[model samples]
Target: MNENASSDVKAKRQILIGLSGGLSALADRMRSQHAIATKITTLAARAEAIAQRSWDLNKLNSQDLQRTMDGFVGEIKTFAKQAIDAAVRAGSEALLGKEVAEAIAAHSAEIARLTREIDSLPDAAAVRAILQPLSVTLNTLPARLKANTAMLKDVDAIGALATGLAERGDALAAGGTAGNRVAVELSRDLRQFAEEATTFSLKMASEAALAVKAISDMAQRTLGLSQGNPVSDQAPSATDRLMTLARTGPQAGQVWATSVSRTSRSSPVQGTPPGVKW
Candidate 1:
């Protein structure tokens, strides 16, 4: 009878061991599923945000729009790369689990899609075309101002000439031949005054042109940065994700295992008699 009882106990232990193993496997599968789901959700959210930003940028003019669009494109690319790295790391953590690999592959596809979309956007040529007129106008402003200054200088000279002629005529009328010399001197002074006035007008025009040129240069630079070549290459790499997963997965697994062990230990054993007679 004792031998039979011993055999029964051994069989029960074997069953328990098999059940525990199965439960552990199930838990791991569930965890992997959760990780994948989380990753997918994250990627979707990122994509949505990127799309929205793109739409917003579309509303702006070429000069105003490209900066915002470029920023969004860069961010999307960066997020996608980061996601890929995370997936790779997660896969490594789960011992190269299928779910992790699937997630990573999905992210990679998304990144590629974003890249293509960004590349397909209108090139700087179109932007330049739009801005070229403005640039030309700006470039011409200084010359226009300078011409205006020259015209003003001529006006000043005319005014000065008029004043000197009037003075000389008055002196000649009052003192006749004796005032003649004085009149001639006054005439020379008037001519000098007219020339000074012309110079002043030209100076004003030059100053205005300079101011306009400065503003134009600033606007052009801003536009160039927005639509310029060689967009930033700040996306995350696959290796980065793998390393993160390596660091976090073991810790996560340990926490899960500990919780399971505790819960299992705490639970009352099955098949125990409710009321046993000793």
Candidate 2:
């Protein structure tokens, strides 16, 4: 009985040792599995963080791209506005130029018409008629004065003779005969003076005619010059027209510069990126 009991105790001791060994092995396996699970969890967390960072980076990149696109769009709009304004300005200038040219042309036509009317006046013909007779009379005046002087000299000689006779008569007491001789000499002198006065009148008339002719010539010449029909051969040239256009047209540089400045100021600025400095 004692032997059987000792044997049973030994068997129980062996069985306990085997169970402890099995438990220790099972604990080691559990520890290894726990370590693997911890590693896996850490790796998963890291991957999630990396993915989040990537998303953030993508968002930032997209925002930056949007901002850049907005800037580009703004610039494009500015260019378009400039182009449109330039076109409008050009059109306006063209219209202004045309209006100015038309106005100039109208004024020129009016001037030409007035000139023609003035030239067509009957003043020249009337002036010619007035001058021609006056010129003839002036040409004959000197001859008439010479003839009149000769007649006056004759009258003076007759008067001297008559005076001498009268003195002789007075000495002889013949008063009636002396008075008759003096009367005849006075009458001759009056006739000569009258002829000379008539000659002078003719000369005056001729001078008046010459004056009329001169005035007519001057008027015609002035009209011709005003109409650009210079007595000289020189005519207005293409350069003159160009100068006129320049004086009337808008300045090129000023128009362009103004348009550019206006377009720049009126254009919108680009949108800024989120959390980024302009």
Candidate 3:
């Protein structure tokens, strides 16, 4: 009977050991599941916060773009007003025909009105539609005025108009921050206008003896504007490069002339140029 009791006690101890080991493994699994649940909650909260911030940023950017557009429109109106005033003054002085002055004022008014309409545009495409005709009008104005004999006779009047337009264009270009595509394009347009005005001034200067002083002043301002505001980091076109060089002095002009002659001689000719023999 004593031997039987000893075996029963050994079996009971073995059953207790098995129960303890099973309970320990169950506790470990519960802890692992709790850790995984906590990690999932943390990641979800982080993602939600990021999404909210992104939405706010998009709203701010949209507001900022509208403000920029408004500022650009204001500058354009100012530009049109000043140019119109110059043309009207010249007309009153009999430097150009009254019809010409009326035409200029009419064109400028249309440009200003169109510029105001840009504020109501829904997207870039609509704005570009307005800008297309506006650009053509702006580009053709100086040439049209230059074609009139009466207008070209008064060099001072032409100089006044050119300089005024250029100054206002510079101001308009300053309305936006760096990296803004609109500002960069406006700056390029200003430079091109300056170059064309300078060319016109030089051509008229050759014909008028007493107009030297007016031409000099206009050249100085326009050249300064062109040099100061570059649209990009890319190298300037060959025409622009030579134009800049030609502005320095007579010596620079001579150097450009020599280079042109050399290029002409060295270039291979597939056919004779117009008004030239083979």
- Provide TM-scores for the models: 0.27, 0.19, 0.22
Question: Model 2 clash pairs?
Answer: 131-209, 134-205, 134-206, 135-206
User: With candidate 1 superimposed using the best TM-score fit, by how many Å does residue 174's alpha carbon deviate from the native?
Assistant: 81
Each prediction's total of clashing residue pairs, residues at least 3 apart in sequence or on different chains, is 4, 4, 0
lDDT of each: 0.34, 0.30, 0.33
Please list the residue runs of candidate 3 whose C-alpha ends up more than 4 Å from where it truly belongs after superposition. 1-63, 91-187, 201-278
TM-score of 2: 0.19
The most accurate candidate by lDDT is 1
Query: How much is 60 displaced in model 1, in angstroms?
Result: 2.6
Superposed on all Cα atoms, the candidates' RMSDs to the truth, in angstroms, are: 39.0, 65.5, 39.3
Candidate 1 backbone collisions, by pair: 85-241, 149-202, 153-198, 157-194
List the candidates ranked by TM-score, beginning with the highest: 1, 3, 2
Off by over 4 Å in 1: 1-7, 61-70, 82-278
Error of 2 at 169 (Å): 99
- The TM-score of candidate 3 is 0.22
Candidate 2 local lDDT, 72-170, one digit each (tens)? 334323432432332222122111122223222222322233334433434434323323333332233223212122222322332332233233323
- Our tally of clashes for model 1 stands at 4
